[model samples]
Target: MTSDTPEARSALRDSASRTLRLEQQAIAALVERLDAGFDRACELILACQGRVVVTGMGKSGHVAGKIAATLASTGTPAFFVHPGEASHGDLGMITPGDVVLALSNSGETAEVTALLPLLKRMKVPLISMTGRPASTLARHAEAHLDAGVEREACPLDLAPTASTTAALALGDALAVALLESRGFTAEDFALSHPGGSLGKRLLLRVGDLMHSGERLPRVALGSPLRDALLEITRQGLGFTCVVAPDGTLAGVYTDGDLRRTLDQHSDLSGLSVDAVMTRPGKRVSPETLAAEAVRLMEDHRISALAVVDEAGRPVGALHMHDLLASGVI
Candidate 1:
């Protein structure tokens, strides 16, 4: 088959489609296999006093690593230990309080199976995920999850294609179930992923990005429109917050408001800030998530928001620039 031949291209596309279909079917079958064993696996992890130690061999080992990461990030304390390394001293990492989750498509991978007796000796609960229910690993486990697939995507029926996909889907299902059972919030997930954008969305609060104290652009309600414009210029926020006599937010005056004011008349001396301000503008609490603040700004077609205290007084101000600079937008 020539690399650029039309027949070869067609075959390549067909092969990809067949592979996806096989994997999809494998995952669909796993959904029906969620039975008492699945529930028992969840129960064991939930009841575990120490972290979960996930181990597997070959392609199953790669899937095991991903599962361990997902479980760890989603509120379950988990880590992957290479099965081959377990016999070489990593077995000491497993304690009596820990739960061992072993993955193997055949359930007969020698490296993974060899650790069974030691795990049993440590009195650690063993949860096995495998395609064969009658395999050695499955027979020895306290709970056996059948991740069986009808066929491999490999044309030779020798590679771990559909089986590996089934195992990955099952691992995701387990992690999501454990997450729900633990009442894991996005904030909790962010605590484990502080360097990612998801962490920013969940952990970045309004107060963290807002201009507080003297940095906020503010003017008294009856202050001249000229004073408000000057305040906006001084703060470089494109807007100034209008405060009432008690220092509570009364309205917001923006460059857009300024344009409208200038178009109405050439006289700036007679107008008060309240006369040109957009009244009853949206306000957010200091504790609000920065993402929520961005949503509020987008929904209202406004570029700025006042951060107020419980008493409705302006404690800080936020602009689109601040959100953009903080990667909240």
Candidate 2:
């Protein structure tokens, strides 16, 4: 077999090196271009009464969708509407109160730029991100962000690489700036993501999951062991809470305790719950986060905890199943 000559290998290495170096230069160039127009874009979106509608064609379209998601998830109400779809029937989605964010490396993508007149006519503010400041898209936009890059990562500098990254980063910056200006909080984020882990952490409070009243398996401190077991079974929480006369949490009796107590005597009905209950049981407050409850349950290797009030009275109880069923786990 013929071996590659040193000259052939050197050419390949130089080509790869050039692509990497040019792409790095492109990113650096984009960093230098952030200015007043970028701030204008943020101001325009923040001033928008409706959602930010992001649109682009091809690679830019993919980035636009991601940017829209980031904006929606953070605080801004935004969604992606494809430029081609907008040309068809989706133009109706663009309202006068909405802000349109159009992305194009050349600022001349026919599919994206074709909707400019309609957007202008609807009186919707337009923010354009493009590599060419003199391009039609830039000149027509209410605010133009220069996402211009020095060169592509491709060896021939023909492919869309660094330009797309610059545009995506600019979109994120806009979303974050709007997020801060709106004073968006974690609760707002949870509202947008009701089914995700963030929602559980931020929105799912301990009171929402804790079993209360009769549903909370509870027995008086002096109750018989047999009666405590009955309460555990009827409540089906895997454990029964033992509270003092003043309603403060006194102790707990679990399924494991029943087994240990039963080994000594066949009849536990004569045994008082106070004599067998484990005192100072693991406890949490009604205001605690469900995520923190899960952590405590896992770290302590136990399920089912009594929820206490600020004054140390037993108000509720919670089990691992409660967290899983409530979508907080």
Candidate 3:
């Protein structure tokens, strides 16, 4: 059998390292090119009354779709329209209130450039991201971002490797900048992504899911154990608050307490709720975030908690099931 030589290994390593270096150089070039033009592009998108229409061809099209999604999830409304599709009836989606962001390494993708005249006729602002600022698309754009790369990662420098990566990063930078400029909040992001976990974390508040008013499981301190059990069953929270006669949270009774009480006393009906209730129970305030409440419940190995007011009066109750049902946990 022939043995592998150090020369072959060294050559392969050098090629791989060179490709990375070229890509790094491409990204560095993009950073240097970021200036007033980038700012103008961001401002144009922010001022857009309609959505940001992103279009590209081939690999650039994939990046454009991702960029559009990032913009939509963050605060700016954007959507990707394939350049080929735009030549058809899809061009109707573009309006004067919208900003058109066209992506092409050569700045002259035939499919994308074909729509330029129509976009101009509609008076829609054009923002170009391309490797060649002197290309036709860049020359006609209101703002041109130089997404040029030093070279492709491919050995023959034929593929759109480094250039595409640089363009995608530049697109992300623009979207994030526009998001910040518009004062986009987490809640705003959640509103756009209502089905995602981030939306649950940001939009699910304590009050939104907490059990309130008469639905809250509560028993007066002097109430019998049977009454406490009835309260827990009626509320279906696995526990009940033990309130003092003056309407203050005195303690809590749970299934655990019932088991312990039943073990010590044969007749639970004769026992007072205070006699079986666990005193100084862990509680949460109405203002606490529902996610935080979930953490507290999990950490304590408990299923429910009373939401107490500043005066220590029980106003509401929350169960782990409530959080699970609301998609907060």
Candidate 4:
């Protein structure tokens, strides 16, 4: 198959298209197969006092692992254990209160089938996902999920392509249904993924990233420009918040204002901080998302903002560098 040949290119495109269509049809078939067994499977998992123990062999094992991860991240506690490993010693991980989800395309995989008797002896609830409903594994399961597909996408019909895709889709359906029934919120998802970008966006708040207490640069309303400059330098925020006698934010005096004052050739001897400050500058609440803070900074073309309370008092300060250091940028 030469890269320059039209015949080879056509063959590749046709093969990809056929594979995608076959997988699509396989997943579509699962929609009608959603019978009472699905509800029972969900009920078993939901009512499980312990975690959902997922087990399978070969390609089914890979799908089982992903399903277990999805379940754990979505609010249900679950983990994957290989059927082969279970026979060795990992069977001890399966407690009596846990629900077992077994995956086998033919439902006759030796490793998976070997565990049926032990699971029954332990009195653990079994939910089997197989292509053959009448197979031994399915017949023994408390609830059987039929994930059969019409045909494999492989030309030889030996590789597990369409069947695996259907099983993965069915597993996703179960995870989503369980998630909805448990009312799993995005905050809960964030708690499970606190190291990723999604976690930063959902879990990091303004208060977590803002500089408070002595780190907040501030100058009183009647203070001199020189005093505000000292506060800005001491705090190293490139700006200083102006506060009223009652400690409420009055305005903001940034380096930009200093440049403008210099352009006007204004004398620095008698200028109060309020005389050259930008009043009512953009501010954010402590509970605001750090991602939203980035948007506000980008939209207004500013580098710093005062974190204020409900009474308009400057409680904290945030700079662009703060966000960058916190990985919110």
Candidate 5:
């Protein structure tokens, strides 16, 4: 119900600015509060023989779900369960081997608090996150992560604003700490995300995208220049591998070489490919990652490469076009 007047716009900006500032302050306050209690939570989860089951009510539920996902993706095995659902036989989903992470800003959410007795009987460990450390839920847990904020960013101090932001940031810090302690690598991260570009960069090998057998362009050492040119044209890789009499890679002649050679000599009646090829051309092995192959091609200013084996024999051919087609570019 505000107008388009400058005064109204300025008031709207002020509200947004205040909200951001309050949330920023909430996150900053968590820095010193991170102590041995945070370490205990990590140790409990890490030592557990099973998954970490996270549960919460209301806005805390949304934040709990995200925390579970981040933990699962990083290295910890975790999943989210609704507290309300837990009372309806879903409680059977949890077992003695699992650790529980319960979130409740007020620390006394009825749906969440009701699980305490059953969890205690099952002998499962509980880690509570709450704004009030002395609250019933926090007092019953093994580790209490204090996500308290001075006040809500909501002007009315009722809506979950700075509290949720603080909780989310604390969850992220926990996941990252576990990831570092586990020595997780990008390769490990890629394993968890195998369908995207990140996975392709780490998993796709040169052999997976190479052109081999009949599709590979190659010529013999004593072959005529016309034969090499024909193979290059037939394969459309813009280059041909010249093999020695022993079936080993001797050299390679590219389209660039062809253009340059033609500029210097027109009479090719007695010329062999060996005399005009680039010896020991830039090469790669089938085990190389397609991402690494892309770097090699770009580094050498060439569009194609000869895939060689340990015996110096050409096994296949790789082109920039092949990389592009495979979405590795």
Candidate 6:
């Protein structure tokens, strides 16, 4: 049972603080220990034409799966396989051309060490992350990354804690080094994660959200003020493009313009949009990034803008609402 008493809360806070410090110390120690083995591990993964097969057991397995995901998303292709499952026909998932990354705190987990001979028979290079340098798995590996920690953060000193943090940090360092070596870019990462927010930021374009074709609201250069208002109301975009006779954009009339028109004239005179519209109104090319469009809109205090062609003709229109729907705002 947990308690909210002052003494209990103080004890809880102290435990959390100690755990965080131990985990941080574990991660910090890895920096000084990174050596030739780390380089060789990167070299093996970079040279492999096949996917990287990462395997571990228990808590190490959980960290191994996360490392594999980070590797695949960052440019290297990798996947996780359970050591127990690999001995049960999943070994077929690994190819001779692939490299294997095995993690075990003791470096002697029976299920993990059992696969060493098979890996050698297949002539596949092995990269092992372990706390024990003299253990079987570490001795068999082509490159041995020492992810050892001084001690577990657990009060009982038995559970995997600091050791797991060290392994995970080491894995991230290896993956990032490989990412830079391979010239991985944000666009490449976005391609692999098109459904994510980073992908939306890097891959989404203005044309993808801007209204085009029949949905686009536009009016000729000398169109009547009533026509522009009707187009705006019909499209519900708060604005309509005003085009010249030669099909070039002349200006834009918006709800703001309508309010101004009402303020300047009391009589319903023969007013055309050319008389009240904003001349050479703000616009962007269809190829502009949606993020850039957001900046332009915010900077100009605009709620709606036009997408123009190279010749300055209206091809599409963008509204702040579309950006909101697309999660760009």
Best by TM-score: 6
RMSD of each: 2.5, 4.3, 4.1, 2.2, 2.0, 1.4
RMSD value for candidate 2: 4.3
Predicted candidate 4 versus true structure: per-residue lDDT over 1-329, tens digit per residue: 79679998998999999999999999999999999999999999999999999999999999999999999999999999999999999999999999999999999999999999999999999999999999999999999999999999998999999999999999999999999999999889999999877789889999999999989999899998899989999999989999999989999999888899888755887888888899988899999999999999999999999999999999999999998988877
Candidate 4 vs 6: which has more TM-score: 6
**What pairs collide in candidate 5?**
none
Cα-based RMSD of candidate 5: 2.0
- Give the lDDT of residue 324 in candidate 1: 88
Per-residue accuracy of model 2 over 253-292 as CA lDDT, tens digit each = 9887777887877776679998878888989998899999
The TM-scores, one per candidate, come to 0.89, 0.81, 0.82, 0.91, 0.92, 0.96
Tens-place lDDT digits, model 1, residues 196-287: 88898889999999999889889998998889989999999888889899878998998888899999978989999888899877899999
Q: Can you write out model 3's per-residue Cα lDDT over 74-95, one digit (the tens) per residue? A: 8888999999988989999888
- lDDT agreement of model 1 with the native: 0.93
Which lDDT value does model 6 have at 73?
Answer: 96
Better of 2 and 5 by TM-score: 5
Tens digits of per-residue lDDT, candidate 6, 89-187, equal: 999999999999999999999999999999999999999999988988999999999999999999899999999989999999999999999999999
lDDT of 5 by residue, 15-68 (tens): 999999999999999998987879999999989999999999999999999999
The 10 consecutive residues of candidate 3 with the worst lDDT sum are 1-10
What lDDT is reached at residue 131 by model 1? 98
Better of 3 and 6 by TM-score: 6
| Top lDDT model | 4
Quote model 4's TM-score. Answer: 0.91
As for candidate 1, its clashing pairs are none
Please, what is the whole-model Cα lDDT of each candidate in the order they appear? Answer: 0.93, 0.88, 0.88, 0.95, 0.94, 0.93
lDDT of 2 at 146: 93
Runs off by more than 4 Å, candidate 1: 183-199
